[model samples]
Target: MGVAAPAASATPTDVAPDAVAAPPGDNLALTPPMGFNNWNSTHCRPEFNEEMVRGIADLFVESGLKDAGYEYVNLDDCWALPERDENGKLVPDPERFPSGLDALGDYIHSKGLKFGIYTSAGTKTCNPAGFPGALGHEVSDAQQFADWGVDYLKYDNCNNQGVDAVERYTAMRDALAATGRDIVYSICEWGQNQPWTWAQDVGHLWRTTGDITDTWDSVMSIFKRNVELAEYAGPGHWNDPDMLEVGNGGMTDTEYRSHFSLWAMMAAPLLIGSDLRVASEETFDILGNTEVIAVDQDPLGRQGTVVSSENGAWVLSKEMADGSRAVALFNESDTAQHVGTTAEAVGLPAADAYEMRDLWEHESYQTAGTISATVPAHGIEVFRVSPDGDWAQYPSAVEVGASAVQSEAGTTAELTTAVTNLGRTPAKSVSVDVAGPEGWTIEAGSATTSPALATDAALTTDWTVEIPPGTPGGSYDLTVTADYRSPRHQPRQDSLTVEAQVLVPPGEGTSYVSDLAFVREANGQGPVERDTNVGSVAAGDGTPITIEGTVFDKGLGTHAPSTVEIYTAGRCDVFSAQVGIDDAAGAGGGPPQRGSVTFEVWADGTRVAATGVLNGTAPAQPLTADVSGASFVELVVTDGGNGKNSDHADWADATVSCTA
Candidate 1:
């Protein structure tokens, strides 16, 4: 069942390197190839090399991966013999591969699939005991690969010393040209030396990073580093972020979903490196996420780009085929950080209307001009955008009621509401009414009427209105009433409440700092929050165990703390502290002195009994602490700096011991 070879051009079995000719147009065909590699299950050392390759071939079909897009069954390094012949001839190891490659090739072809082999561009193969080294023998090795019916060549980079990788790669490119076969050349340089810039000219896809471990951190770190290169991948050439480790079990299902979401976004080669014989249900779901897969395989070939990286948060977005865009917001902070995105941040039109879809949850939403969402600690949200037409432009009246927004005093914020056509056909006139808090105002043009919204199934319209200037600040409640041409033919109303606060101008308060965020959950339990903010405290000062953050008056004559927490590695339990602005400088004297307090934090997961008054009146002192034999400690504020009750909380740094 092997695919019929396109008429071979001048099958000159012994042609010289320069004598080879290039195909008329582009010869590369596949894009972001979906395939299976043998390293994960085999650990680069399969017990039954030939048999396992065939078994995986069988699984590829049985698992329905071939129909779902996975096709190639690639054998990684370690399949070759210990050495090449003295005459510089490369051959498969007889003892390990007794039937030789021709029979193996036949076995694979009989199943209606292609065959691929592994080699290295350095002096030795990846395992140091493989047949042909790719260095000076590039031509000979490549020609041998062609003669063995090899359809793909995975050229690794191991033991590569001084030889320029680019030059060595071009040498193999030339050598592969000498062979009459149209082989897919894959470069495995681990993304070092920025191989992506030239990968298109030399191979099908270039590995962008080291081998990805079966851990969430490894997968996430790799995805973050590589998603920006989405623009570099295209039809013939692709940016490979190394093989996938989906089913390999070092991470949870949530992490695996994140892994697939990223790879699909980056358009990296989906060469899975897991045990295909026993893939889990979750693995199938990951490999079969059609919405995400569609983004990777989109014809435009454009990759997602990072727009912002502030306050432990990041946003990535990509333009889609239907004239819409997809976006992903990441909260990389230790504690949950409320975050949002404007149309400008994602290169979308600032027009008053647009339709947005949350890809992870597979739900549609609506926004005025800006799209925003709350990002949980270490969590992410992906979105798809479409223009407005006649369909309801926003989420269901019920769903829209859950939207959140935040604003500072004197900052006028606008929220749009609309309904667009999500159906293939156009609809009659549609409209919506928006209402805000008493002090807020629904400005003119807050409601939009678009006939074009009836054309594209993805079109939407926005209801634009702003919060009143100098309005008393606090979480404001907004409501929208939608009148669409639906069968119900009735107006539906929804409401949302967002935290709003006016902050004291910058340079007038203490600065904020944070610690490295780490995953603290295991197994079926979800990840927990751990605040490790450290500040310098004198050697003998007792550490304050109370936490504080800014708060805003809710117009009810009361203010609430944003968030509060404390951390320490010692047994100091009972604690107390007070919170207030360090107003020793007095009002109009410039920003207040540091607002601080004192409290003791314990090492055990025990609570601290402490009380303090957070008065917005005057500045307070920095939180202080004291103890002996204590190695690590930290003060934490769970609340985001919103308003007057407290100046930005400051943590006095402390030292810790390295003993585990």
Candidate 2:
């Protein structure tokens, strides 16, 4: 759900006629709201129903997440009828929300949790989940939400009919307050309207970017975009970089830990966007890390800042209430990197000998001098600093990532994890243990061994992890843990765990993939605040791809199915496709040039060829690139930063062939 915030210009309206003004000091979100949002998980799919909401709420109560500050359970888009009732009030989609929204709110409240609903500030909400927006009916909808006991409102900015963002959001703010309901207003305008510049008092949190996918690039892109805008984030008024993708399986445990740690340090809200019902244990741990939550929910409300950056490595620091500090060392490279910096570099007094506690590893140390750690590639190490000597909490100091050679079902695969000591001191008697699927036989490096792990030293742990010959192929998380003693710090023993995603492919051999094949999950257009496009698109009716209002220019380019993957395993791999603008991808849904775009073909993430800006004025053009010896080919379309107003583009007759 890497969608930008929705923003547009529109007229305003007054408050509800009969309702009283909200009570004073009704600013509900004293801190960033921690909760669950459905849009990221189910979206407008038929499965996004009341049962899902109730089950999530129940899990929140049962999973000890509520105790960890995850309170609000929000319904992002959908959940409402296409139009308002005769009384000019919003109605829940009875088919999906059988008990209605009011009953849903009551059920959530019964679990001692707050309930939130979604709406847009424009005349029309996001499509497919269509419903009249609050532009002309703000007062009425606000009153209805209050009547339903709604505690929060995620007000979006889709189909604004060209409304000024500040004015529209202000009107909705006044309307919500007039309903006499203390609703936490969340402004989602895709950061396009620069809500941070004007939304101080209008809303609690504002989106700062487009939708976020569960890819390393998405998380890293968001971190880069939102981290620099720390000046605008504080207690109630926060800069949102979209929802949580941790535990979603797209990223590794190390990456997820880094994602969660970084977001918390930025003082962003902790709204989870994963399927709670089937959330794995790893997901629960990441979501329920109250220690990290404390940093984000610190009463000071000051967002963390990047005090130092070098060679793709950075130190993000935040000041806490008790004069303590939180710091994270991030490594964004492909190899492990050691970033050495002092506590003072992260905004701490050089005179104080601060005790550092690793938030993720759950270990403590007393470091009087320089603080340093050898971080894993695309991983992070977080710590809380205090002016106290506390080494008793030191348990284990190990960071690990696993890779498997030959992960096919019938073949015996060798799974290896490199365990690195991130501690201030050396670790003795280092031993690696692995536990995998129930039926699989996993051979370890040793039952007991002594590997002295000096600070920053790496120990390779090999396991002949064999998958049952007939075991169905799928992704499996093999848990890898390191056990050792603190011969340098403490006498007590310690253990640390990491979950490695082992994927078993369908089959091996040369295979043909369609250039028309698509792989992206969500539409380039966001839901609720943008065009209502299908999650999956087809070149239907032997015409252009017309699922939803989105129209692919060439009958050959279908962006909905998935981003085409031109796999190349030989010496003569060629990828070719026709590029054009999607007639409906413009701001006004214009044809051709109105939705100007440049299509770039990436070979294994490196740009190979790009078409010049294409629009209605230009005829369809063909693009071809040699993907020889490349494992993956990707097609990316950009609006050249001109905005995807009507940028409905198409890549027709896409073909990937390896002649060798």
Regions of model 2 farther than 4 Å from truth: 1-27, 247-254, 309-311, 334-336, 351-353, 368-370, 389-660
Residues 194-246 of candidate 2 have per-residue lDDT tens digits of 76766767888888887777766667777898998887776678899888988
Q: How far is candidate 2 from the true structure (C-alpha RMSD, Å)?
A: 8.6
Which parts of model 1 have CA positions greater than 4 angstroms off?
Answer: 1-25, 85-87, 93-99, 110-112, 128-131, 228-231, 334-339, 350-352, 362-370, 374-377, 388-390, 393-660
Give the root-mean-square deviation of each candidate in angstroms.
16.4, 8.6
Best model number under lDDT: 2
Score every model by TM-score: 0.59, 0.68
Tell me the deviation in Å of residue 627 in model 1: 6.6
Query: Candidate 2's C-alpha lDDT?
Result: 0.70
**Clash count, candidate 1:** 50
- State the C-alpha lDDT per candidate: 0.55, 0.70
